[model samples]
Target chain A: MTETAGTYGTEFFVRWLEAVAEAVEREADRLTELDAAIGDADHGANLRRGFTAVRKALEEEPPTAPGAVLVAAGKQLISTVGGASGPLYGTLLRRAGKALGDDPQVTRERFAGALGEGVEAVSRLGGAAPGDKTMLDALGPGVEGLKVSFSAGRDRAGEGAAGTVPLRARKGRASYLGERSAGHEDPGAASSALLFAALAATARAEAADGTRTDGEGAA
Target chain B: MSAGRDDDGRGGGGMSAGRVGIVLVSHSAGVAAAVAELARGLAGGGDTAPVRPAGGTPGGGLGTSAELIAEAARAVDGGAGVALLVDLGSAVLTVKALLAEGGELPEGARLVDAPFVEGAVAAVVTASAGAGLDEVAAAASEAYTYRKE
Candidate 1:
């Protein structure tokens, strides 16, 4: 199993972004419903537009390297999302892509580490730590889960997102709602969980197909 | 990124050496433009620094765009540098994300988190007076101390 780590190929990345877009589309209204309680109620629409642009950008100038793919997607989201999530998620993918270096493919471990960096970048940019009722709640644990087990990471992400329902908002606009923010799922955390879920599903597909090469020597 | 590279050509030094470029970021496009106008008015309109407004989404929604702000930063950034004044937390985050992309902001650029209108007014006025990057940034920061009890 260790010898068959999934490769972060351009195809995988493209699929990952598309899956995220699909998941966001599937849950857009739910996301907006959650946000309506604590935020501007635009998270769903914002991400829908952002990921659509990300897909369009990839189609416009498809890149071979995984980093380039993510960079382009990140750039599109930064330009189109039009909210705090725009910068937050944009920084996540952009910083993660940068951390991935110029490699055309990467191992699951390496990809997870780069993703952790991306999540950390969000923490730095928003100054929100774990349990802040922000995306970090899910993203932080999801990164850890990835380090442990891809499947476990996915489960942890779901749990982490659900866990936000009881935490009071401490950052972003939701914080302005005070204690009222409790009981409502954090829209950012929910979206982040969906992103991880997409990644996990993609990884599952690769593992089943035996296409998960551990990047033995390419570095 | 290239902000430093273009810092020496646009507004060469003098009493009004390229007014330190000012980018106003807000969730409301109209608010941002209005603030720019108000700041220009405060600057007395004569040889004032460049003030660009980057507010709302491209479609006129209430939000901010990193690309738009970066474009504004580039447009107004002459030789001196650019100072960004944001209206909300997200605005600051967008600027930070734009910088992390490793492609915007002049060498001496700054993101000043001051009260929107006051900071814009003070920063541009200082820029119009031939003040350098730090000086104008200081003026913007001083607006934070402005109390209208």
Candidate 2:
């Protein structure tokens, strides 16, 4: 959204991570408010702290590979972020990182596959299925859309996140609320949608930059 | 994170040889340490088996940290392996993430998903008496059947 370009290398992930950080910061208060309805009301503060550490860690070490960056960020979240979100998100990133291997360049298909692995890790760790009003709901749609196109993936992810509003939570703290969890959006699903939105934004920015470079060459 | 915690000459700080160690994980650092202290009393008082507390974030906030847990796991490991007890959701996930990294655990190390306080006390007491890794883990898991009624 800020016109920052995405590329083939790990830089895309870096940009995506930054975009998600910005998006999360913007939605932090809202996320916490949503949590107040069915969770501990720490979702915003928790992710804010986690992403801040991730940005700091990346700046400090500056990994070359996309997988390395994910692994690094995931590890940071696991240690700095509290609650089940830390581990769940951490496992998602770390597992996806492992799936990507050490490849510096990634194809869209490969990235999609890797993301699927990450989403699966989240599900496996949390034992939450679709219709459970969890992050997986958003991530599941995002991954499927990613296999189609980046922008579509993000759009579907946002829709999936919003769709959780009317569902009853069946996992995490919200599960304790039973039927009361209905009519409220899941904080995890919201944050998860932000992540997919960041990915799509990064991709658009990259395309814009590419067009600019081509025009400059023709000129 | 660093691995292979220094093996103290004091048999892991007064712990007997070949004993299974206990690790306590929680979102609050103070809570984990306090629980460890209380559990130590119930286990065998001070100088009992190696009991380590992995709690909070590196910045001392209320959150679970895989890095801290990994370090604690390494430190608490004796020859017989370690049994880990976690408080809640993220705590369990954090430990699983650390293990999922594919690092070689200390022989027979494993995570036990049981009530933090009760499991830690039970596992600690079992380990202090030279219980095996499975035995210690079982003791912690067995605490799941405990009830206030």
Candidate 3:
């Protein structure tokens, strides 16, 4: 059977997680550097440790449903990450996963709506809004653009991350810095943009692969 | 470490019944244990409430661990509810997350909003006096209004 575009299954979610782990590994130092300017310098290290744990968990159990995949990943993040990002990102995934329910395959629109709920959960958890120089800056816009397309979501999230460069933080550890928080992009927002990028890349890769059976590459 | 073992042993017993427990959460293992010791000392000797420290990462780094927090909460919980006093930042967030998630702790476990050291001291002292969860929490919260002048 051929899986069409705009619909994702458990494998796609798994690949997306894999892509995120790789991207986070590659960009950890950069994220930590940005964090050092406005917040603690442990953002990169914390996320790297969290994602590494997430990767290990996926390898160990490998949930069959997309929602289960996300829920499991979120739980690992909450249990392991040891920073604000842990609960924030963990809530994002856990809420989105719960929204997805047990659906084995989800349309892009359904996924977008679920992701929007996840972003809202993050906002509620952190008590921050779009201009607060938090992950919501990227995540809120990204979910909006996700309603349109994966690429659009990726682009909007990236733009929102960059847009944090000039904003003073109004929440989290950075808020303590007051005026000194400006001129540095929020590390959480930067990592959030990477999430969208991974989603877009996974969708693109799926499209390029075209009409493959689930058992074709089972290893 | 010896204190931890002793606390665990005493906590395993139900002789100190009807007292609220206290858990101190901090980013540093040394800080959490030291504060727990101070609070216990300040609470005085005979029949003091169970006070445990849940601090540092599972790998023993400078960060809070939800798993450790949950374990400590369980360790300190008596028939009365547990009151958790946190040091800073992630400690607060981690406790909130655990509470929001539910089922990870005993029923009625609460995060008391107060200064770390002072709040722990107040909470332990009040709990040792057989105060309920709310009274212990209130005592800790009242620590915020303390005047050093």
TM-score of each: 0.92, 0.89, 0.92
Question: In order, what lDDT does every prediction score?
Answer: 0.84, 0.81, 0.86
DockQ for every model comes to 0.77, 0.71, 0.62
Model 3: TM-score, first chain: 0.95
For candidate 3, list the clashing residue pairs, or say none. none
True contacts kept of each: 0.85, 0.82, 0.59
Sorted on TM-score, best first, the list reads 3, 1, 2
Q: Pick the candidate with the highest TM-score.
A: 3
Error of 2 at A180 (Å): 1.2
Candidate 2 Cα misplacement greater than 4 A, ranges: A1-7, A211-219, B1-3, B6-16, B58-60, B104-107
lDDT of 3 by residue, A43-154 (tens): 8999998999999999899887788889989988989999888888888998899899988788988999998999887777677888999999999899999999999999
Worst 10 residues of 2 chain B by lDDT: B1-10
Q: Which stretches of candidate 1 lie above 4 Å from their native place?
A: A1-5, A210-219, B1-17
DockQ of 1: 0.77
Considering every candidate listed, which one attains the maximal lDDT? 3
Question: For model 1, what is the error of residue A130's alpha carbon versus the real structure, in angstroms, after optimal superposition?
Answer: 1.0
